[model samples]
Target: MIIAVVDGMGGGIGSQIVSSLRDELPSYVEIYALGTNSIATSAMMKSHANKGATGENAICVSSKKANVIIGPMSIVIPNSMMGEVTCRMSEAISDSEALKILLPLIPEDFELVGLENKPLILLIKDAVKLMKKEFNIK
Candidate 1:
């Protein structure tokens, strides 16, 4: 299956997600790194994503092709990531046919109620676990 890991800014979260997925999933499962900037894409590529693309159009096009999309919750928030995620990018991702698994990392201006502030690593692990369950991966 093709899994897309989307991220922005420094891409620290996406890199971690990609690295964890590389460790947990079969090698044949393609990982597409979709970054909002070149630096973000480069970071994810270093984490060993099978393919990498940057910018809005890349994200929009790749989202549709992905079987699953995993990223921070801000991915669906227009003008999030300090404006790195545009409205069209968020819309494309939100509208994509792929199953989305978003980590609850929101921007400072936004707040989500009733969720524990877990460490990023734990969140990534939980996301990966859910992905395994959803795709029936061992």
Candidate 2:
């Protein structure tokens, strides 16, 4: 399966998701990440996605191609957060054939002792579990 992880700016969230899934998921699945910025894509690539891309166009392409899309629930809403995520990105994702696994947890309070954010750990775990069920990974 091809999974897409979309994120903005720093990519802290997307990176964590890619890494955790790569480490825990079976080899059959491929993660394709699209970051709104280069940093986000690179972070996720370092985590072990089969491939990654950055910027607006990448987001649109990945959303359409991925078997599944994973990210914060906010991403579905275009014109949200002052356009950190564009309407094109949101539409490509929402209108595409991919299933989405969204988490509503606030990005704040998501840290692990001076780290970026730890709440995402739980989110990732939950996401993986959901993926397992959704894709029958195991």
Candidate 3:
């Protein structure tokens, strides 16, 4: 299965997700790091992603081929990621025929209710667990 990890900015979150997935998941499950920029893609690649790409078009096209997509809640919101995420990118990711597993991260001007303010590590761990369950990894 291909898991597309979309992230922007410094890509700290995407790197963490890639690291955790590489450590916990079988090698057969490929991780595609789709970044809004080169810096973001490099960060995720350093974390051992199977493959990676950058820019809006890359994200939009790659997302469509993924079996699953993991990233911050901001990914689905148009013009998010400090405006690095464009409308096409958001729409492509949200419209992809993939199971999306978004972290309840706090975005600008919006608070994700019904979610505890957990540590970043804990949130990432939970996301990994959800992905594992979805694929029956165990």
Ranking by TM-score: 1, 3, 2
Q: How well does each candidate superpose onto the true structure, as a TM-score?
A: 0.98, 0.85, 0.97
lDDT of each: 0.97, 0.80, 0.93
**lDDT tens digits, residues 86-119, model 2?**
8888888899898898766334434335424447
Clashing pairs in 2: 110-117, 110-118, 111-117, 111-118
Q: Candidate 2: where are CA atoms >4 Å away?
A: 105-118
Residue 130 of candidate 1: its Cα lDDT? 96
Tens-place lDDT digits, model 3, residues 1-138: 999999999999999999999999999899999999999999999999999999999998998899999999999998887899899999999999999999987467997667789898999999999989988997
Q: How far is 50's C-alpha from truth in model 1 (Å)?
A: 0.2
Q: Which segments of model 3 are wrong by more than 4 Å?
A: none
Alpha-carbon shift of residue 74 in model 2 (angstroms): 2.3
Better of 1 and 2 by lDDT: 1
Q: Which has the higher TM-score value, candidate number 1 or candidate number 2? A: 1
The best candidate by TM-score is 1
